[model samples]
Target chain A: MNNRQILSAAIGSLLALGLVSNASAAGKKMDMEQCYGVAKTGHNDCSSNKSAHSCAGQATKDRDAEDFVAVPKGTCAKIAGGTLKSA
Target chain B: MEKPANDSLPCIAGIGLRAPHYCEVLEKLPKLGWVEVHNENFFGGGASLRTLLKVREHYPVSLHGVGMGLASTAPLDQAHLSALCRLCDAVQPAAVSEHLCWNSVPDMTINGPMVINDLVINDLLPFPYTQEALSHVARRVDQVQEKIGRRLLVENLSSYLSFTSSEMSEGEFLSELSRHTGCAILFDVNNLYVNARNLGVDAKAFIKALPAEAVAEYHLAGHSIRDGCLVDTHSTQVCAEVWELYEFALQHIGPRPTLIEWDSDIPVLAVLTGEAEKAQQRLEEYHACFK
Candidate 1:
């Protein structure tokens, strides 16, 4: 697949895992996100020992966005409080 | 953006350069040898990249990636590699590295008759250590290095489980990987400690297996016990035992750029500064030995 397809696939996985949100953008511009949520067992972004704010102490309530994922652009706006973290 | 590009990281101690400490670091310009950061955090151009560029203006930065999943069975993620390329082009980091563990895989199951393949992003998970696995990892490392236009440093993992079908230890796997692909070793001491505590891995033996020059960086962190298993939490002071293991690494693997990683329950900047200072002392002693 081409770059856009490759990017979309990666971001799609991140969105599926709920690590990032999905948002639509102008022209098929592929974007990735740094989203928060409990991504994996050993692989959550940073341990969410505290409330969500930054990478440090990113622990959230049960199954929240504790894991940071590279999601497609425009996805995070759909995620409540999920800011677009990356391209 | 106007600061001179740092050629290399000093054989001294550095911190992970988390967001919490960015402002303080940029303002104070404290006495740190260098700084390391998570590559993904600065993937896109924005305030984060701007802040990183400012940080780059002062000290050398090491780009450490947590989500590369180099060993996953699925095809390598090109977008991730592209983002890294862009980041490297912008930051001109002293070192770029990723973990040896596999963090994602293609999901394969069936709805009774059909199969599905979904990319499963995970924390670093265990994989076999066979020649086949080694070949796969080396090929991926080569792809990454070729894309980034530099030698990538692959780190050791702090595993909670073991693969009985594995053909070699993690150290051996890393050593052979380095030898085959010419990638260097990041040599995370705390990871070895966690594995040993949790899986009876021999830390000293692992260090002995490495080629000294291949060890380009060292990671020092703290671990917490979860259900009686050690976790590479990176959330506290560098414990005394981990420090001892680090000393062992320095003695065996020799002095390299070391980083103090504290991710969770991050305390004040002073706390990380103190931890870095401790690591700095160990580094100094290692250098003094040659003097």
Candidate 2:
């Protein structure tokens, strides 16, 4: 198979394996080929962001905008407090 | 007494050989009396162990352990002890030592580089030196000696807090433990200095109380200041004050295999060699006085 066909098959296997739990699992689903194309474009756009935080924030915003999931505020602060301490 | 094969630990000074300078040291083969490395870092058979063996060919090696937790309430880690025994057989280290403090508890928790915390976060947790704790540590020390087939040296630890329940001072505890188990002491002069400043422990008295025959080695390292307390950080150059305290220890304790240790933000080989040179100078000065 060509590269595009191989990529499509890998994405199909992941989705079939129920690995993409963060995304919507209901309603009529997009085929693997379509999902792969969308992901590739989204990744290119995210990489252009100035900082990792901006990229992650934009990704979360996009996911929420698409009704993928709810993004909570100040989650980073809570995680930082729980993890950072002296050894 | 007949020295062990490959035994060359000078009654002078040496450096804690770290990964950053292993290649350069092997190539140059600097005029060092001996070198020490953390035993855990070389437990696995890999490049690190390979390099240490190469370095071992040139200088006497001392395996200083930081994770044995001899006083831990938990059952002794048989795997850790086994790894140490295997490394000893392979390296034939001139000496092997562990700290006097406890790092593991009944819950199998640990502290320090493997685990970090502000208080009781599993890393080298200090406890009250009660009679029960002393017996626990003595039993563990006995097990280690039996397993390793050699007398183990235990070093004193630096602490941020003191226990209200401690029945005796740390020096007294160490002396008693040595008396009971026949373990040698790896006296770290910088740790004594830190304890003296932070907890108001009298360093001179502690030094005087120690059984001189039980001392097998000496360690000198730098520490950092934190909120009016001295922390045994071992990052920077050996401070002037610690050097002076080391001189006092040399005078009292007599000549031992002194090691210069710098763990964090390690500098160039020249910098560590320079530090080792300073320790060598001090050891020589003490010898001169005896003459």
Candidate 3:
């Protein structure tokens, strides 16, 4: 098959398998907000500002200083001590 | 509305935009001169690229790369290069930069065809600063600039140890590399400070040796000291000593686009902005000296 034909078949297979469509659909509706002060120790999304750990899952305290979790907007405030802005 | 693309980096203070602050920065649109992000993070089309594009709409973006491995003996990673090219096309970044270090090497061949698989160290590894290495790095820089169609800014590395085999200083090697490839320099003051503390590098002499005209930008980051060795962890505020060295650099190299980079233990958006504001104050102070 020609290069164009090969490319078309590969993309067609991805579409038929719902991989491309699923990713496209997911990308369109991103509403996740960073909910701060709620993540358990060693359970944060990425890095922390007040802690020595730089990578994910390295927080040393339960009430992390600057670590966060991604939750839907307006729900973070409902959790006790959770704020949109970092403490 | 999509903001017009800006190809020139403003000589002002900015923060390194990490993943945690993306949502907040996008939502609030804080006043900033510019912002930089690791180019490798947004190589694919998804939420990450989408958010970066949205950031491009507000502030000029600079693409800082960590995985280019410019001095690697192995052939340049074409796939990584192509991805970076596509990212530049999409973002129209004000600047593009990579570290002056090696990451991978070719497969080892022992006596009588005993071959070992190639290894990628996956970290910024330093090499001896010699004429041979200089020529090799210069050739690689030429290839990268040709592929990207722009001058690549090479940042000096923060090494923990010095090589006895090195024939020249890191600053001299960088100067020769810029002279050979016509590339620019991204002088990281914090990296220099770390080298000074850890390896007893002469920070002042290194700064004086650099080709001031080739310096296109400056980087300021915080580091941590462990067991008498300073590590460029970028997890805290820029220390007083690094700031002093930065002022020395400003006096020598002149004011340039400076960035406050906090990678590990990423801080709150306000803290990052506060750090950027401190850098802005220093830049203005230096600029007022001439005016």
lDDT of 1 by residue, B102-180 (tens): 7665666677856667566556677888999999999999899888878888988878788889999888898899889
Per-candidate TM-scores read 0.76, 0.71, 0.77
Candidate 3 interface RMSD after superposing interface residues: 7.3
Candidate 2 per-residue lDDT over residues B117-197, each given as its tens digit: 222223444678889999999999999988988888888888889999999999999999888888888898888888899
* DockQ-based ranking: 3, 1, 2
Segments in model 3 whose C-alpha atoms lie over 4 Å from true places = A1-87, B1-7, B109-115, B288-291
| Candidate maximizing lDDT | 3
Model 3, A65: alpha-carbon shift in Å? 28
lDDT (Cα, tens digit) per residue for candidate 1, span A1-87: 999999999999887876333343421232112221222123433332222222221233355565757565776678876875555
Give one digit per residue, the lDDT tens place, for model 3 in B67-167.
88999998999999999999999999999999999988888777969876656777777899999999999999999988988888999988888889999
- Compared with the true structure, model 1 gives a TM-score of 0.76
DockQ, every prediction: 0.05, 0.02, 0.06
Instruction: Evaluate model 2: give its lDDT.
Output: 0.75
Which 10 residues in a row give candidate 2 chain A its minimum summed lDDT?
Answer: A52-61
Query: TM-score per model for chain B alone?
Result: 0.94, 0.90, 0.94
How large is the C-alpha RMSD of every model relative to the true structure?
Answer: 13.2, 15.3, 11.1
Model 3 scores a C-alpha lDDT of 0.82
Q: Rank all candidate structures by their TM-score, best first, as comma-separated numbers.
A: 3, 1, 2
